[model samples]
Target: MQAQDDFLKRIEKLNEIGIALSSEKDTNRLLETILLGAKELTNADAGTLYSATEDGQLKFEIIRTDSLGIAMGGTTGVPINFPTLPLYKNDQPNLQMIAAYAAIKGETVNVPDAYEAEGFDFSGTRAFDQKTGYRSQSFLTVPLKNHENDLIGVLQLINAKNLGDNQIRAFTIEDQQLAESLASQAAIALTNQRLINDLKKLFEAFIQAIANAIDDKSPYTGGHCHRVPVLAEMLADAASRSDYGELAAFKLTEEQMYELKIAAWLHDCGKVTTPTEVVDKATKLETIFDRVHLVDHRFEVLKRDAKIAMLEAKLAAMQGGDAEHAAQLEAEYNDKIAQLDDDREFIRTANIGGEFMSDEHQERVRAIAKHAYVNEQGEDAPFLSDDEVYNLNIARGTITKEEREIINHHVVATIKMLSAIPFPNHLKCVPEIAGNHHETLIGTGYPNGLTKDQMSVQARIMAIADVFEALTARDRPYKEGKTLSQALKILGFMKKDQHVDADLFQVFIDDKVFLRYAEEYLDPKQIDDVDPAKIPGYDVGA
Candidate 1:
């Protein structure tokens, strides 16, 4: 009957240890569980678990004791070294005795009185008991070993209780057996927790590396990805403050804001695949190479031919004694070349601005396109083909239709790439936030052609930011950078046309959000002499 009760008690202790180990995957929490279980199994007033360092030195991972006031509050961990104790090596008699005869060795060491133990060393244990107020009647230590028989740590239990005397008593064989069993479970849990921590660190490093790669791609465009997130956050903050009718309208939390910032940084990640020439398109009708310059030279040739023809006709007419008529023809030919030169100069200057041509500019451009020139074959040629003339006359934007299609495809590529990434649950919105930037409320946008109803607040903010930045950017090769006043004027026109959110633009201007951002982010030279108040209908508050 007593044997059955002992077996049942050991099983109960083992069950408790299992529950403790499985409660947490954290390494620190697992160590605490080991200490608590060790104390309970051995009926000790105090218990500690010491994990070995890479250098073979032991560090106290956890400490628990009834007398220690609920696990020492802040004294959970300590170093186990010479000042603490002379730890035993495997060859040491004390260590061997514990390993060979204690419950860890599949036997049990019943030390009735540790100070009087005949076959084991008790000096270290006795000294520890004397330093504290605790009396040591028994000392039980177990090795926490994993399935591979590798030692993970050591568990030490002190002052086994005597039920009859209601005082500290010697450790029993059953107590030793119980502690060893608990230690074994702790080893497995600790190993598993370490593995989890390592994997998490690796994943975080990978994410940081990807962001850095994106940042490093273009030298002139440095910090572009970094700044987008910051601006996105500011916009989101402003949006949330404004009174939108629906409470459930998409509002960013701190975590959501962080995710959106990450998404902003990665929004142009697909640009990696786009040719650098396209990204830095610096000339009118520039492709891999510019062909417009050739057209300009052809026009110059036609002007030269026209002058030579007029001179020849004058010589012929003078031969017939019509001197006044010949001179008039020469004067008219000179005037034509002068006008053609002026138009050519305007075309060259116009390409330098990199801005989309306005309707008035396009009309002027079509007139220039109709001007005749001489080809290399010396035949009469219009300055451009019919299609080229049509394209030049459209005045839709700086980008040609083909170039616009390529630029628009980036949004599609962004969505595809981001969707394939296995983002964490908190960052699941990355793809949506990135891909939806080009979308508009009026269904005129590209990639997905998503309407306003399909767009989120984040998407709208991104669109505004993209357009504003492009308008104000000075480094672009093709177009002259707009002054702040000019850029705002354009934005105002866009708002009036219902292309952008007027309310948000009003809020942006009234709050001086752009000025605030420019102070921190724009170069001092870029901000010089810029007057925010000069913007049309500038309001301090909207």
Candidate 2:
């Protein structure tokens, strides 16, 4: 009756330990808790947990003992060579070893008389028991089973003490039952931990897939989203290695690095809302189709009209029998066609040059509008309207202020879309990181109009990377891509205007990060003409 009461108390203690394990999600903490509980419940001097390995071997995951001499840190329990033992599931052991026998049989094992059982084999168990200067009398071993009923590990308790003799006593059936109950609880906790880990991995992969999909959306921008993350990582790595005191202080941990990569990939996710036509806008006056082609048709009409006027004048002069008048009319007609052709040539080249409109160019374009025609509807149609000529002649800048707004709204859409995403707790900063790429220190940026204080270093790095990629991308539909030197020059001007961090730009250049990226990912021909010397204070030889 007394033993039964003692068993009940032990079961209550095991239940308390199980409750404690339930609260811990961290794998290391749970393993430690399991070992501590096993030792306490069995009154054992030492305990160890062995997890089954992929190769059908038992590997030690945790080992805890009462001896203060053994250093507990960094030792992952002993590896048992499976070939040396007659270990098979449900098979009996040659030696009456409690732990090994329980593992092989997939059942809890208890030994009540370890030292004085003549028929009981103790070949494998005796050596370790004798070496510890502690007589081993009782042993309790339980096989840890997962939810699938597969053996995950084994929990062993050693040197169970006898209450009356003050010596070790053999483990009883009651002890085996208690150990099995604890093992079952541990298996459930471990299974839950594994599920959580798998879910985390799935979430990360899903985010990466979304980033890849964004990159694959446009042919010209196919690798851009992918490249930004790579560049961001390189910059981060450089910052981490810098000797500069301030930069070194901002070192990124593994988790921060991961978050930064995710943010970088999704930085332009808002571009999805941006119209593809606007993104691929090639011509200055381009809408669905270029209106400049209409201008060419207008020039053709002027040529035809000039010819008809010459014919009319020549016929009237012939009626009056004046040969001189006819010759003069023919020359005048040819001159008008020549002048019109020259004007058309000028417009075509100017439109393609992609240079911003100069005041002189706009004036020339206004002067060409004098050759207006009377349409078949009796409406006077200027070869080009004053406004049409003005916009067409503006040469390289955007065609309309409205189009510029549409282009800039991509930043706004990006912020809105990212804000709607349900990022997990660890990734709560992702929306801020993705949205702040367009922000500046001087509050001159758009969308949220964030200042430097509201922006993180990750955001700043992304902003720089976006600008750099944009300036150097030859595949862009609108402007001719700048040479590397030109891109750097422009970036320098932007820095002077407080659009980007000057020090960070300098660090990025000095670290040769861009050069490394160009070599690895960019076409050699695209960057071949770049002269590092053209960048102020930069030495190509160095």
Best by lDDT: 2
CA lDDT, every prediction? 0.67, 0.73
User: Candidate 1 residues 1-542, lDDT tens each?
Assistant: 97678669868877967986876755666677678767766668877667656544445656666764535422355433333222445645234333223423433345667767786666666686678765666667776666777666677777788655758787877777777677667778877776767876776566556656655654445556666666667766776676533423646777787676777777877777666656655555655666668767776777877878998999999999998999899889989888888887877665554345677877787788777666677777778777556545445444666676786777888899999999989889889888887777677777787876687667777777777776766555545456566778777777666666655676667556677767777655556454656555444343
What tens digits encode model 2's per-residue C-alpha lDDT throughout 410-497? 7778778878988777677888887888888789997777787778877888888888887777666556566677778888777778
Once superposed on the true structure, which residue ranges of model 2 sit more than 4 Å away at CA? 1-220, 353-355, 376-378, 385-387, 393-399, 528-534, 537-542
Report the error of model 1 at residue 96, Å: 20
What are the TM-scores, per candidate, against the unseen true structure?
0.61, 0.67
Lowest lDDT sum, 10 consecutive residues, model 2, at 68-77
lDDT of 1: 0.67
**RMSD (Cα, Å) of model 2:** 7.9
Residue range with the least summed lDDT across 10 consecutive positions in model 1: 79-88
Runs off by more than 4 Å, candidate 1 = 1-223, 236-255, 270-278, 310-330, 353-360, 394-397, 421-424, 442-444, 449-461, 464-472, 480-516, 528-542
Candidate 1 clashing pairs? Answer: 353-479, 353-480, 354-478, 354-479, 441-452
